[model samples]
Target: MSLSYVGTQLTIYVGSAILIAGVLGNGINIFIFSSVRTYRNTPSTFYFLVGSIHNLLYLAINLTFRIVSVGSGFDLTRTSLAWCRARSFFLSTISVISFTCSCLATIDQFLATSQSAHLRRYSKIELAYRIVLVTMVVWYLQGIPWILYQNISPISTTCVRTNAIYAIYVSVYLLLVLCVIPVVVMIGFGFLTYRNIRLTIALAELRADRQLAKMTLIQVVLVIISIIPYGINNAYGLITTGMTKDANRILIESFISTIVSLITYLYYMGSFYMFLISSSRFRHAYHTLCDNTTSNSSSLLCLVDDDYFCLCDINQIAQCFLYDKTLDQCKHCLAQGQCIKGDTDTPSDYVCRCPRCHFGSICQHNTKLFSFTMESLLSPDLLSSSFIKKSVSLSMYIIVPALLLIFGTISNIFSFVTFRRPKTRLNGAGHYFFTSTIFSQLSLFCLLSKIIHIIINLRGLFVQPMVNTILCKILSFLLSSSTRICYWLIVFVNIERLYVTIYPTKRWLKEPKTAKKIIIFVIMLTYGVHIHELIQYTIVPDPKYTVHGKWCVTQFSHSLQIYNQINTMIHYLSPCLVNLICTITLLIRPARIRANLDKKKSR
Candidate 1:
């Protein structure tokens, strides 16, 4: 086979493997959760079952589509429009629902476990019914755009515009529903979860197995990673689809879409492992299964003591950081022990001692009565940071910024209302600039903040093997670009004010309507300047967590670092520069003119 053919085969196999893994993994969870008669009746079971259902559907579609697309031999561009639209609509909907269901599972775990007595008694059947209703509403809600604008036929695998007007309508609707609404919901929930976690931690409430909340956080990250590639792909598609008939971009986007689909499954599959690591029950069960299946396995060499689980072969902890073989000492306490000791045991095999109050086993003490206290956990500093972090919690991220935008818009409305008032009809140029600033701030605020958090938060929740060097750079660029929009708007405000004062009779400054048009134009232009950032910062797996059995994103390139510096320069330094220059000009201009007039009068 040609290298191309081999690559294609590998892709298909990988996709299949991921799909099977997710289905079987989640299916086993379903069986285990269901077969236990006591477990089947619990309210939490409903969420777990529903989340599994969504995962199964998502995996099936993803696996089938990827395998078919790879082997089908037909130009993706030449596939039937119906096939394209239907596939697009269903897959997107399922993907969204999967993430949403997972999030709901987290929420359910919180409410169910936290409030055990009266609230715990809520019927599983009623919970299932409510989920069904929600599923129905969400399905129809997401399907509207598909029904209205989806054009699938065999000739070309692409979206068919009902017409330009309808296309715009569908785009607007889809943007609001898929992109905007979920982002808002995620941000809200993220904030709430952050607060709850902090409070739990602070109040000494977080036990060893607070897996649900962490699982929820991981789910959020999955959504972010899944959406980002798709979001960028779609956003780019929307911008360039009509302007350039480039096959490469389309193909590139399709590849990204496929990758994102696969990663979404990875997110679902990986969470079970996270649960296994964090939850004692899952960990115990998993280890029991592993031991039962492979009596003579290499893993059998591992030893578990009261303080630590050790991998004999590697001389390291089962899950945590590796021992520094070269140092042969506790790098964690390097200040005291810089050199390796003569002891045969590796540092990784050494049990991790608590920062304070070194006593018996660290894990055992956690469960001991009066060993921990809410007062100790909920320290003054911890509480303060919790308040701040919660105030800016990821869930409320969208609403807070959105509310700020609304307030800015309201400020404009006030200006307009004042202008229309009989008493204030003769409002001056300052009023016009103030009104203009309101609209500018509103537009930039809504677009930049919402889009940023939507993309950023989703990445945090979902992206696996988290370090995608390329993706990190792309994200950094997009962030820089988004922030630039705000800075540029501030510059415009200062410039407009200075212009009106310096040349009041200019036709541009005379009409408030003209100023509004300019503001809108600037807002639109902001996208053009930063579009390159999205392209430059492509998604790649994070490096730090990959080796240690954790996943996350981090920037790899200095290009993003440069861009960040530039953005900071513009956002902070430029605004300050503009303000400083304006302030000095306002102060000095009058004094200079008066001095000249006095000189003329004496002459």
Candidate 2:
């Protein structure tokens, strides 16, 4: 196989950029959070730091593959099945570790911030170890997909080998374990935290109130934001079924899918930012470190081979950032008074170049620089060419969504019916809310799966405004409505929890009739919002026009796109804001109440 110079160069450039960025960003994070003695060891930070490490590892694996594939055209059979299995296993484990760590962090915050002593006791090291061990088990168990699917097909040009049946089973497993479990857990934990927060506020427990509330908001938002893109992407992969031998189509789809997969990294990256935003201690420490650039503090610098640079105090960090750059002090800078006393020639520090800077360096005079835009990132020609090469079928499309809808319906119904009985009713509103969440999850999963199925199935069909007229509309509507339904269900549960906690004596909550009504109303209202999707997903096919083929499960009309973006903002972004606002309000109310009590006692 021969590689185009441009393709090889681009691969190297992108791979290098990703590796460098991941190393620095995750390195600084681990150092600041782990080594700093002042950080007051919290379970939240521990989980977060570990998660960052996992993210860096994930980046390393991805970068390694990108570089190797570009250089050698990525031959799987030549590399042996062992190499494939190893790569798959490493990738899978790191990915799991990243999300699992985030989950643990959320769980930690929820427990730590909760008002109940029983819940608060969950902040033990033993529990953390147990969680970590269990997560590892989950990772290995999930590796069944890789073990089952690992093979070398004669026609496959790429290194990775995947089959339709293997993909479907893995997709089903991933959807259930990773995507659905986290969604349900986030909603459940968020509600539990909200409830405990309200109780704390009523009792004037300000510290716990603020901490728990902020952490809850951060965890919920970060998890949701990061998971959705990758989740949807995987859902598409699962529904679209089959392993094509087409090198061109596979490469193009894989490249685009790689960008989508970055959503997982975004989730990991956002945690540091969330901590910066929501926790004052983190913010103060970060700001203080940034502002004091002149300070020769050990915290900021490490001597490496007689040159100064940053070092982190972790196994992962040290492994990632140990630089071997030769010592070359900035002679020009020293002569120009840019260097301080005793500063001979030192190696140029790795600095971030501005996107708008002309040169990839810190310019003395700022000049405009060109960077890759979204248009360049996703070229129209590339998309069209990729679409042209796609060998897709109607059955692939139909069966995938049908499978998802069926699976979702069955899972959600089981969750609801099993917990609906009088026997499990005493399990509390947490269990009931869990059931409701499963319904929303199924709704979202089915809608996405169904739509992708339609678009792919209809690609080569000559039916114009005939076969797909009604189907498109219903598919589109159901997808949108189900997603909305699921999003709002979570918020409803959170708000209900707040109500129950603050007003525990309310007889309405105790009444089975009232609870049932609330559940029905929430479910009905959620599905009602999805009605629009039912109306709009359908499109009139043109006899002369071939549908643009791709693996993503989304409607691309401007109006629909705008609506979905808004949906993302409302269901995805806005709830985060609500979580933050509610948490702050809950915390502040108690602080003010406590101050008044203190004043009274002093008087």
Candidate 3:
């Protein structure tokens, strides 16, 4: 299997494991730290409490999407426009908050361990509360740029940054704020806290304070280990973005990126486990709490002896899964889906991990990206390999193309001839009409070539490989550019008429000189924008993913797709919209003058 696919399968389980473990661990941490009166008001513990909540939020929202995205191979952010803008905003805001809380907990521990009374006083619960509140507000405000910049990219059909300047700022922010600052602050304070306890173990460090210090300090080390690799990966990505690589190298890089991204979640999930390892008092608390639980009777507690291995077997794990059949966990499931019980002990803890199309937690959405192509739309049940032969009778395909070519040629020639007269060329309107007629002829000829190319390939006809390649590039390039040229020429025609409508007395408005310049500019601009077709377009033989016999195809890069689609829209819509507005305004505010007539009365 390719590493990307393998990595995707791994993430399906890994993300689930993290979600379950994180929720349970952080859940217990929150309960023990809050419910136990001895630890309730301590500033370090307060930060721990808040950090646990942030970790839960991170796992629930971010890691859940990460798992669904991998399992289905479709990102929700890309498909849903609101989510495209909101996911980045929330993830950034919440992650920075979680990282900030970790730092605060470490720094608070340092102060709690310090010999100085002044620095120690700074570790107050009231100040901790205010700091977290202010941090939330600041980071929420900081994430506003993401709301403004994140968008569903048209080319790649994925969510990505839309603004160049904002994208650069995001890269810098990812490197420094999310990756660097928290690690630095925690490590620095973590060591200081450790040194204070080591130097003055007998002087004044209480047992609880020492345990909390050890927990936070050990957690800091884990943070550095988990987070620094993530930072380095981000830097490597930035450095190598423009470098070209073979397909295998691209897959390898993608595999590594996926692996590193999963590892980054470890920092958020490992804290409670870190506490369990570093604090004996914390472990004692866990046992004491678990032994006392009466809510769910089905439990398994495994204890391994130093002298021998012991296995604890408990029946009735699914007892809680069926605790509430009326809960309707399978409401979002597709056909033949099975729900798996999770979330430790809750009755509402079922996630629908289906055998097919595991799209969401409950399998609610479609598993694949949906799109339409000409062959598919025309004959949904027919074989795509021999498209034209299978979809069309021999006579029908021949007759349609013949009719189109004859009528199109005649109409364009007639329009060209009509606009060629000197009397008709007295104004810019005639020039625009003549240019459009020429473009229309160009479009018709390209269309005929495209039809011939498709028919030859699909009907099992042979052409030389190099000839096919050249035809593929030339035909697609000429067709797209010529069609867009026509659209833009119409746009300019509307604009010129609108100008004449507004300024009837301006003699320059009636000249054909500016019209000629604009037509040339439109043709050049359209050709320039579509020049990528010459390089990006190519013939693919017997490909299942795209349409046509020559099979002209190129996958859109994320930013390029969004940009190209928007540009096409502007070219297509600008003229139609300009025409509507101009015609309506011409109707609304009739001009005072007319060409070659008396200056009209003021409306």
Report lDDT (CA) for all predictions: 0.49, 0.53, 0.68
- TM-scores for candidates 1 onward, in order: 0.39, 0.41, 0.47
Candidate 3: clashing pairs of residues: 155-561
After aligning candidate 2 to the native by TM-score, how far in Å is the CA of 32 from where it should be?
Answer: 2.9
**Model 1: per-residue lDDT, tens digit, 171-201?**
6655555555555566566666566545543
Question: Candidate 1 vs candidate 3: which has greater TM-score?
Answer: 3
lDDT of 2 by residue, 53-172 (tens): 887777766654555455434333344777677777777677777777776776776786665557776775567767777887888787867866776565753345478777566567
Expressed as tens digits, the lDDT of each residue in 1-603 for candidate 3 is: 779779888887777676666766777678778886657667778888888888888887788777756654446686688988888888898889889989999988888767665776687788988998999899999999999988888998898999999999999899999998998899898888888878763311222256778889888887888899899998998998789999998899888877887888888888877886687453222222232243445355433211222222243111111134333334333333465556546655666655332233333222221111222223222343676765565446556767887898999888888999888888887888888888788877877776666667654465587888788788878877787788777766776776776577885756788778877888888888878767865555432322433344433453454445445545555555446644644543342223213434433
Best-performing candidate as measured by TM-score: 3
Ranking by lDDT: 3, 2, 1
Error of 3 at 244 (Å): 1.9
lDDT of 3 at 208: 25
Model 1 TM-score on a 0 to 1 scale: 0.39
Best by lDDT: 3
